[model samples]
Each structure stands twice: as structure tokens, then as C-alpha cells.
Target: MRYWPIPLLLVALFSAQGANAEPIGFVKTLQGGNAVIRALDDSERPAAIGGELNVGDTIRTDRRASLGLTLKDDTIMSVGPDTELTLEEYLFEPARGDLKLGSRLGRGTLQYVSGSIARLQPDAVSVKTPTGTIGVRGTQFVVRVGR
Candidate 1:
């Protein structure tokens, strides 16, 4: 009976850890087919409208599938069919002037729009592909990575 409190404490600790895994963005739109999201430490799941996405998550869209996402800083991203993109890193705290965004697109196409993070610190945003990295300068751009 004395050990009962121990399990409760453990559960609380685990729950707190899970709570710290904040959502970095959400699925704003989708078309053609379903998109899948693989969390940093979780299995793949269907990305539905309004579904939350966290840092380190990988979003994959199959043929004829597309996805649109809006991040915490209002940065907009659209993934075209057969695309693989990862939210490698992100930190947005305007008050503290701490803003950073980094992502990698392995294949397919991506459309990006600048947001508060880019407006706050233009040099803090980067999108990488097999060839090289693209530095965002408070602008909108599209990229396609060939398979």
C-alpha cells in the first residue's frame, strides 16, 4: 500500500513530459488524398484538417495528395504530392526576439510564405533540399526536389 503513491507520482511525471511536446503547427488544408504525419517519437498518423504538428515531425503526401500547414508564427507551407518534409527545428518567441525555423524537403514540391518569424529575423529561416539550403528573406518561394 505504501508504494501506491510511487506509481501515481510516476504517472504524473510522464504526463508532464508529454504535455511539454507542444504543437508547432496545424493542418490548415488538404486535397486529393490524405497526408500522413510521423511524430518525432511516434508512429505515422493521418493528418486531418486542424491536426496539430510538432517539431521534428515528418509530413508525407502520396501521389495526388497535398497538404497545407500554418505554423505558430503564421508561416504557411504547402506540400505537393509525393513530397516529404520535416520540421527539423523551430522556435518562435517574438517577445524574447528568439525566432528560428529550419526544415528539409527530401522530395517533391513545397511552397513557403514568410511569417512573423521571418519578419522578425530574416536570416533565421532556412529550407534544405538535396542540393542545398535556401535562406528565406521575408519572401515567398516554391521549390521542387526531384526524386
Candidate 2:
């Protein structure tokens, strides 16, 4: 019984730690219709405004839906309808100047605006599409991926 409690306690501790981990970004805005979100290790759900978006979360907009996301480093992304975007990975530790952002866009339009991560580490940001990867600088740009 003692050993069983110990294992249960450890599991609880780890589960609590993961639950307290910070999210990578948030859904700042949504327009037209609902957006679906597939979490890293969870099933798909409807995305709500102000919902936290974790790393590895995939977002999809329906026919006329649009979404705006604000990342931890303040990077802004606007996703158009009929688009699929995934937050592959993101690390933002400004204290040591360590910042990285990687994402993939599957079929739709996206408008990206640089943030502290890009301004501090210009080469650490990348957005991949079906064709190629985008090299992001400290600027805003638009990209579209085709089916």
C-alpha cells in the first residue's frame, strides 16, 4: 500500500506540472464561424476566443471562418478560411535571447507579423508550407498554401 501511494503521488505531481505549463499562444479573435483545434495529444475541439493555444496544436478554419492568434512572443498570425495551421514548436525565453518558432500551413492564406522572437533571433523563425519553408525576418508578410 505504501508503494502504491508513492506511485500515485508521483503521477499526480507530474500531471499537475503539465497542467500548469504555459500555453504557446491564444486565440485573440474569431470571425465568421467556428474554428476547430486539434491538441497535441487530444481530440479536436471548437476554438474559442481567448483560448490558450499550446505547442503542437493544429487549427483549422471552416469555409468562411477566420482566426487571429497571438503567441507568447507577441507574434501575430491571421488565418483565413479553409486553412490548416499547426504550431509545430515554439520556445521563447527572452532572458537568454533564445527564441524559436516553427509552424506549418496546409491550404489557405496566412498573414504573419514578427514579434520579439524574430527581432531578437531573426533566423530562428520558420513557416513551412507544402512547397518550401519561409525565412522570417523582423517584418510582416503574407503566405498562401494550395491544396
Candidate 3:
């Protein structure tokens, strides 16, 4: 047998799977059905318990809404009412020494609880806001942006 066809087949398979790759996180809890997820493509969808979350997703909550979520690295976070946040980056591959989690909160409140990445590499986790970036060094922390 020849190896010529293997590369083409592998490329085809990976390209097909790329669009439906696993989510980075999910909506573990939601309140008042007021949270919406705006994708990088600008498509919006209502947030639901267990809803899958992806990188570049802008999570927004109305004045009466709040929600909680968990990432692939076991990181937990919750957002308060009128929140607008973006999941900017994430990479969890401990065996190969790749671990990072980053986000940007434009407004409202954010409560973040560090995960294995912080324990392994404290400098890998951060939450950026209008004022400054919160370098996650502890187990838990909270931040409030604009309002």
C-alpha cells in the first residue's frame, strides 16, 4: 500500500471536523432566560443551561439576568446583570505545557475562580477589563467593570 492517499484523507477529515469542534465551555446556569451569546460571526442565540460556549463568543446579560459557566480546564465563572464579556482565549494542554485562559469584561460584574491552569502556571490566567487586567493568582476573585 502507498502513503500518498493518507495525507489527503487526513486533511479532508480535519477540515470537515473543524467547523464542529468541541466547545471551550458551556452555560452551566442561567437566570431569567435573558442571557444571549453573540458568536464571532455576529449571530446571536439565547443562552440556556448547558449551552455550549466557544472562543470569541460575547456573553451578554440583561439587567435581570445572571449566569454561571465552567470551562474545559475546570475553571468556573459567573457574570452578573448587564454584563458584556468576551472569551478571548483558552488553551489547556498540560502534558505539553500549554495552558492559558483569558477574557475581557466590558461591563458589569465577573466572578472568576481559578482552575488547574492557575495552580500549574499562575501567569497563564487573566481577565481584562476597561481599567486593567486581573492577573488570576489566587483561587477566586471578582471584578466589576463599567456598570
Candidate closer to the true structure by lDDT (higher is better), 1 or 2:
1
Cα lDDT tens digits, model 3, 1-147, are: 546686456656764675435577889999864989999999999999989898899999999999999998889999999999899888877887988888999999999888888889999989998888989986988889874
Instruction: For residues 1-147, write the lDDT of model 2, one tens digit per residue.
Output: 355676457657764675525777789999998899998897898999989898889999998999999997889999999999999978887775767999999889999998988999899999999999998986899999877
Worst 10 residues of 3 by lDDT: 13-22
lDDT of 3: 0.87
Question: TM per model?
Answer: 0.85, 0.84, 0.84
Residue pairs clashing in model 1 are none
- Which regions of candidate 3 fall more than 4 Å away from where they truly are? 1-20
Candidate number of the best lDDT: 1
Better of 2 and 3 by lDDT: 2
Q: lDDT scores for all predictions?
A: 0.89, 0.88, 0.87
Ranking by TM-score: 1, 2, 3
| Cα lDDT tens digits for candidate 1, 36-97 | 99988878999899898889999999899999999989999999999999999899877768
Backbone clash total for model 2 is 0
Pairs in steric clash, model 3:
none
